[model samples]
Target: MKLEPFLLEILVCPQCRAPLNEADYDGHPELVCTAADCGLAYPVRDGIPVLLVDEARRPV
Candidate 1:
């Protein structure tokens, strides 16, 4: 599914509050995160955040 503009507006890297782009797809890599500034990512599951700093990874 395509991301909504408002969702994008409110979304931040969570790790660095940089910016977030679509990172993964449904049942794919799972987490949808991006942080070009900090070079970090945050994972989302079932539309919920994993929120664990260790769980975050660099977007592939």
Candidate 2:
């Protein structure tokens, strides 16, 4: 599911507080951190962003 534009604009990485960009990962929607140093990918489950740092996927 796609997130609302306003919600996407206000959402930031919980770890680094960087702006997040929407992306498709493994056929699922996700919010990916834009910071080079902290590129965490947070899952978007059922149109709700799971911003927990522990639940974020570390950049490879």
Candidate 3:
């Protein structure tokens, strides 16, 4: 799945309000928070981003 560049530019982490970086986790697309203190990973399902804090993966 591909997210539009404009959308990606505007998308931020719901928890930290930091920029999100596109990444692949376990072969699945994800949006990872750029904040070092809040490294949450939001999953991308069916080409749509799930930005809810409860659904995010906590940093290991």
lDDT of each: 0.59, 0.91, 0.93
Q: How far is candidate 3 from the true structure (C-alpha RMSD, Å)?
A: 0.8
Candidate 3, position 7, lDDT: 97
TM-scores, each model vs. reference: 0.55, 0.92, 0.93
- For model 3, give the 10-residue run with minimal summed lDDT: 14-23
Which digits, one per residue and each the tens of the lDDT, describe model 2 over residues 38-57? Answer: 99999989878899999999
Clash-forming residue pairs, model 3? none
* Ten-residue region with minimum lDDT total, candidate 1: 26-35
Superpose all Cα atoms of candidate 1 onto the true structure and report the RMSD in Å to 1 decimal. Answer: 3.2
Candidate scoring better on TM-score of 2 and 3 = 3
Ranking by TM-score: 3, 2, 1
Who is ahead in TM-score, 1 or 3?
A: 3
Which candidate wins on lDDT? 3
Q: Residue 49's C-alpha lDDT in candidate 2?
A: 87
Candidate 3 residues 13-32, lDDT tens each? 98879999999988999999
lDDT of 2: 0.91
